[model samples]
Target: MENTEFRVELVRLVDESYPVVVGRDLEGSVAEFLADKHPDRRAAVITDSNVASLAAEGLLSSFGSRPADLVVFPAGEASKTREVKERVEDELIARGFGRDTVIVALGGGVVTDLAGFVAATFTRGVPYVSLTTTLLGAADAAIGGKTAVDTPAATNLIGAFHQPAAVFIDLDRWLTLSDRQIREGLGETVKHACIADAVFFEALEDAFVERGLSPAEFVRDDALAELTARRNCEIKRDFVTSDVHEGNRRMGLNLGHTIGRALETAAGYTLNHGECVAIGLALQSRLGERLGYCSPSDVARIEALLRAIGLPTKIPEEVPVDRIMEAMAHDKKGKAGAIRFVFQDGVGRLVVHDGGSYARPVAAEDVHAFLQSQV
Candidate 1:
């Protein structure tokens, strides 16, 4: 037998980049940030009901003499839909805001995702900034420029790779978040540590054992939250800049997202994104151990850290494994019937498939078996 190999080159002319500003009292600085970033553009502020009251209104008022428009939607994963996207776009059109408009997303992950999606599509892509209020948005959703809206078929099914002009993480805003919301952000904060930095994982462990740090305490401690948020952003910046289109190392950022997203969709948006991600990390770590990519001790440590941070490490009895598997089939990482997954080689290292895919396709039966083990 003879061996044959072929190579293909795909070049993308992506020059998009943005600054992630993490600090306390950032709400008061939104106007300064926007004025310097998009000085001449009109502003279209997009936020949810909850955030509108807590941060959006304050942000708009901070704009001072700057002219701006405001649009508030009901808060939740449900609002990240095509219908909302259309309504938002129609409102912008009705107000006569053109491409010169700068969409300002002031809220949590949902607002950032939805507003970014709107910014990407409206008038063939306008500029946008992500002023995140929640920890989840600051740590994960607001940084990478992966804007999206959910669909009945799946979550984040319709979206675009539109980077923001800038991302602002207001540490003071954590004061307004419920404890549950802070915990949701920890789901991703722990995930970034598990997949990218072992020392970060250890620091998180120290925060728990020595400093008595927990998700509940995140709101009470701005210094700790700022450190965690900044590290997550640095890791994400490295990945997105290295592989903007998710062609290689960037996909590794989806460490637990394969199953995580499925859990979110299967739960019908009832489960918080980070809650589902915490469960997904638990299940995926076990799967990694089963396939010899990760050690059992490492899996145990991962679960323990997640638990210590006030995150759930097990699939809820309410969310059926079968339903989750069905949802995974429609995940964006799937090709034909093969679902691509990113597994950890160890803490801080990711498994790269023989074909150079950060995410490798696993058989459906294998996935089903993995799911079964969780139950």
Candidate 2:
């Protein structure tokens, strides 16, 4: 996309009272956006070591007159935990971070989630801005007010709904991703398309033809990718707007996240979240097809898109289907011994399983069948 022509509007959710600014290279513009609200002489940035060298310099440079401190954590999903969150909090406190101080997160989903949680808890909530560096972070994780860290028992069971003051997405950072990383991010985008827009889904099919292209290459000429991101953001924004606390509407965004989270935990936090979601989405689609909620063609298209993006459409070979099902039973969405799921009736239409009304409750047999079909 031509840098001059590409424009990302600032979306402000009145309910959450947070503004989302989307644009290429918006990371460089963070200082200006937070200048008025942040009069504190010093700010602390929490980011992973992997991204610190790449993103930290530009962000620090943007601070200019304002002093910025850097706290670097080890990269990967495993780093998102209570221990990590406490360490970050201590760093913030040692730096004399007052209520006026801002916490800037510069990395992928894990960084944003951990740092944002720390920001929320520190001094009973200080302002923070999400400078997302990955596709999943940009399109989903960073937008919503959800911030969390994992526990030994479950993923994201410990967290808070803390909205950032602003979100800055730099499309330029995406250029640094490997093919595998890009494909992982595409999983979230695909989920958004499947749940919200059919056109966006088709657009992703075209972009992933050659194992994903650079942001500039794809976003510049491919209007669809840009549109898909925007549309996906809108879907999430509306959901959060209605249920900022994830009381109702926000549950829709958890379409495949229930099973996805379980898979991540089962993998001992070794798998990327988007990769797990890709598998979860496929499993859900297969279940939907078997239950007659979605057609076989729809399931095929979903799996094909995931594969084209280099995502694993099936569960990992190491994980047993029964274990995955057992984990699913403990999902956050499950209620009163019944597991609930968000299944699609068709493109852009989702129905939450409500105590086996029209939708039959998926049993262990069905899950095993779905798993077998995928392998």
Among these predicted structures, which one has the highest TM-score? 1
Q: Would you estimate the TM-scores of all the predictions? A: 0.88, 0.85
Q: What lDDT score is found at residue 242 in candidate 2?
A: 72
User: For model 2, what is the error of residue 255's alpha carbon versus the real structure, in angstroms, after optimal superposition?
Assistant: 2.3
- lDDT measured at residue 79 in model 1 versus the true structure, 0 to 100: 96
Model 1 agreement with the true structure over 321-360: per-residue lDDT tens digits: 8899888887767666567888988787788888777888
Give the per-residue Cα lDDT of candidate 2 at 314.
Answer: 76
lDDT of each: 0.85, 0.77
- How would you encode candidate 2's per-residue C-alpha lDDT over 153-198 as one tens digit per residue? 8668899988898877777777787766766777788888877778
Return the TM-score for candidate 2, rounded to 2 decimals.
0.85
Task: Name the best candidate (by lDDT).
Answer: 1
76 in model 2: Cα distance from truth in Å? 2.4
